[model samples]
Structures are given as structure tokens and as C-alpha cells.
Target: MRTYSLDDVYETRKRRDSWWTVYFVDPVACRVALPVANRTRMTPNGLTVLSLVLGMVSAACFAANHLIAGAGFFYLSFMIDCVDGKIARLKGTGTPFGLWLDYVGDRIRVVLCAGGLAYGQYALTGDVSYVVLGAAVAVLDLFRYVNAPQMKRVREAVREERQEPDLLADADPLLGPDPLLGPDPLLGPDPLLHPDPLTGPDPLPGQESERAGLGRTSRPRAFFRLFRRLNRFLARHRVRSHLVSGIEFHAAVFVIAPIAGAWALIPLAALSGLLLLANEVFLVYRMWLFTRRHGAGSPQESREHVLV
Candidate 1:
């Protein structure tokens, strides 16, 4: 993994090599070109707004049956989306407000894009397959939003509980004043969507409890216990933490499912949702532990000085 810094924010090539190159690399270069092309200059949010506009235009193109044009515009819009953050970070103006805007804008972009695709599908094939796909994507997008706080909670829990140096965790760019995990006041009443005052919940059903107790009873849970032990051994030997984001799980499902057909994708999507649910459940448990052990407080207050 590559480490990032405020200085590297403006350094196009450096950001390119970070594993997030999938999203940020080309977009940063493209947005950086905006200033070089005209000395008048463009702010990161301006770029983000421009990108949002372009994304809308691209959606329109898709709705108009200009599939290639729409795809091209969407691609560019995504690039700008990526660039704006890089610019913000580079310029040392990556505020929480900007972060919130970025997250909200991403949802809007996904909705519009999916709507356009659904419309385009109807216009072209006269079948609602594309529309259904679009709807599925829209649903997934919402699920993604709802999942953020839970994922953040889990990562925070891992950081607090895991006994390792966690250089990878420490080097994370999404930490400090602008943590990737924060209470999104905008997400509204969905308890799972944002951190709320923790309250205890009922224990898991008997089977899950039994599964968890397997090792306690016999020193091994199941066949997977060996792998878990091996993983622990590796982490202990290497002195690093294993923190996998659930987004990676969705990423794989998103790419694989659609190509595999509704039958395949639907189940994968369901499974992914289950994983997110499980992640959230774990987060709740973690929150309880954190609060009880270290004085209860609002999530914002707990990590006011830190980031995820």
C-alpha cells in the first residue's frame, strides 16, 4: 500500500500510485490541467460542481439514447469527482463540509447515472432489464450510504481493540480532522446510517452463539478455525493489523454480479447486504465496549481530535 500526505495531494504522479488510483489518478490529472489551461484558476468545489453538472448532462445524453456520449461524459464526470478531492487535499482546504459535499454528491451522481441507464435501456431494448439493473444500482447506492457509519464504527472498533502497531492504520489518509467515518447529519433518521447514542441490543440467535463458542468449548471452532488461527499468526508475526473495509466486498459484488446475470447478481447483492448488516452489528457491539470502558460520549466527541 502507498502512503499519502498533504504535499502529495497536488503531486499528480504520487496520488496515481496509491491503490485508490482506480478513482483518483486520472481525475486529479484532469482537474490539475484546468488551472494550467487558464490562469484564472478553479477551486476544488467548483470542479466538483462542474463535474456534477457534467454528470447530469451525461445522464441526459444517456436518456437521449446517446449511449456512447453519455458513457464518455459520465467517465469524465467521475474523473472530475476524483480530481476535486485531490485538489482539496493538495490545497490544504479539505474541510469536513467539503467531505460531506463529496459524499452527498457521489450519491446524487449514482442516482442520476442509474436513472439515465434505466431510461436508456427502455429506449433501446423495450425491455426493463436495464431499468431493473438501474433500480438495483440505486438500491445498492442507498445501502452504501446507510452502511458508511457502520463501516466506520467497525474500523474504529478494530483500531481500539486490535493489539498491533497498525502502521497501515496510522498512515491512513482518511484519518485526523477529516475522518472518512463521521456522523452524516444529512443522512437523516436512519439509525444505521449515522452514529446514535448506543443502547444494548438482544444477543444473537442460538446458532450464531454456538458458532462463536465452538473454540471456547474445544479449542477449535471448525475447519475455518485453522485459517483464522493462521491469519492471527501472520498478523502477530508481522505485527500489523488486518482491517478490511466492507466496501471492497461490495466492489467485488458490483463488478461480478451484473455480468453474471440477475440470478447471480441478485444473490451476491443480497449477500453483500448481509455482510454490511453483520459489519454494523459488530460496530454496535464495539460501540458498547468502547463506551462502557472509556466514558460514554457522542461519537463526534470521542474522536474529535482523531480521524478514521
Candidate 2:
């Protein structure tokens, strides 16, 4: 068996990650994962299961109105959650099942904790608003997770579409005409064989004449320039632009809110939810602008382009 130092565990940390994880969690998690990586025989899957169990215990504590203890357990569970991924990367024992288990476990923990905290508070004060707050937290978390992957796919597809013409042009001189479409009189002399100098190559689809300028209003352009600068600064620090992500949301609702007492939970959770929604909406708007500039067309067109 190989032994790993604290440095080795730190090396497994994600380069671009939420601010909460980078500053608050990684320092402690690396220290904990160090010994587990060196001496323990536990696998990543085992650690994930343990984390889930701790989360359950945290929820139970919340249910009993043990706010301080519940907050402690929730933080500990999240620390363990961070450690599982570190161990997986350090040992190269990661599996598809492990990823799925980690994701599902996270969702379950959020649901349970929300319900427990809300129920405990409602039971104590008889306010139904707590119940609604709990549902809002769970639903927002789920919606973010569900939409993220599809948005990622759309971004990737748009990028590929923008690059496709360049790819084909580069290959045409060496590969000649595609064999299946050997000669099409209707399409005229193959553009590859007899290129027109005056017109230049047909502009990349959806790009047309606006490829150079990106057809952006001055205000949006300036905003994006500032955004890029901010992104670059964040990247330098190995943090992501999304400062208030799902991880931060959970930390705020479960750890900070509980410590602040029942009165603070609803307000803190609401603020966190709003921040999360703002970040998501900003991302969606960026994607919309990107697709418009790149000529991604419709969802069906993007799918067809990707398939091709």
C-alpha cells in the first residue's frame, strides 16, 4: 500500500471550485483525508456512505431542535463529503457508481436537512412559512442540478458548430471531396476544389458578417469585458466565478442559519436562494447571447449539428 502526505491530498483538490469549498472546507478536509489516504483501508464509496450517514444524523439533530449540534454535524458531514472526492482522486479508485452515489446522497441530505429544520421550527413556533421555505430550498437545489448538464451540452454544441467550418476547410485539401457526396452539380463546383477569392469562404453558419464584432450592444460588451476580467481574477485564485453555488447554499441554510437560530433560517435561506437564482439566470442569459452570436439556431438544430 502507498502512503500519501497532506500535500498529496491537497493536490487532488479541484482547481476551479466554489469559494466555500476552497477557503473553508479544503483546509480541514485535506488534513482529514491525509490519514485516510495513508493508513485507512476505506474506499471512496465507503466514505460517501459514511458521509450520508452523518448527514442523516445531522438531520435527526435538527429534527430534535438541537440547533448547535445539528449545525456541527452538518458541517462535519460536508467535510466528509469533500474528503471522499479527495480520496477518490488520490487513489484513482473513482467509479461511475461512486459519482452517482455522491450526487444522489447530496440531494438526499439536502432534502432531509431542510425538512428536519423546517419541521423542528414549525413544531416549536407553529409557523407554516418554515415548511414553505424548506420546500423552496429543496426545489431550487434540484432545479439547478437538473438544468446545469443540459446547459453545458448546449455550450459545447455551440462551440463545435462555430469550429466546424474551420475543421472542414483544414481537412478538405488533404481528404478531397467527401466520398458519399462525390459530385453534386446543383451545389456547383465543390467549394473546396475551386474556392472563390472575392466572396471568401462562406461565413460560418449563424456567424455571417457579425463574427468579428459579435453583434453586441456597447453596454453588453462592456459588461462582458468586466465579467471576463472578474473571471480571470477568480481563475488566478483557483476559484470559480459562481461564488454562491449549491455548496454555499447548503452551508448557509444548514450550518450558518441553524447557528443563528430559528429566526435567522428563513431570511438566510431566502437570501441564499436568491443569490443562487441570480447566478443561474446570469448563466442562462450568457448562453442565450452565445448561441445567438454563434448561430446555434434551435435545440433541434443544435442536436443535428452535434450529431453530424
Report, for every candidate in turn, its global Cα lDDT versus the true structure: 0.51, 0.74
Model 1, position 285: C-alpha lDDT score: 53
Regions of candidate 1 where Cα sits further than 4 Å from its true position:
1-20, 23-40, 154-308
Q: How does candidate 2 fare on TM-score?
A: 0.80
Q: After superposition, how far is residue 308 of candidate 1 from its true place, in Å?
A: 21
- Output the worst ten-in-a-row residue range by lDDT, candidate 2: 179-188
lDDT of 1 by residue, 183-295 (tens): 22111122222222222222256655555664653332343244344433433332211122233333333334434543454466567556655655554554444445444
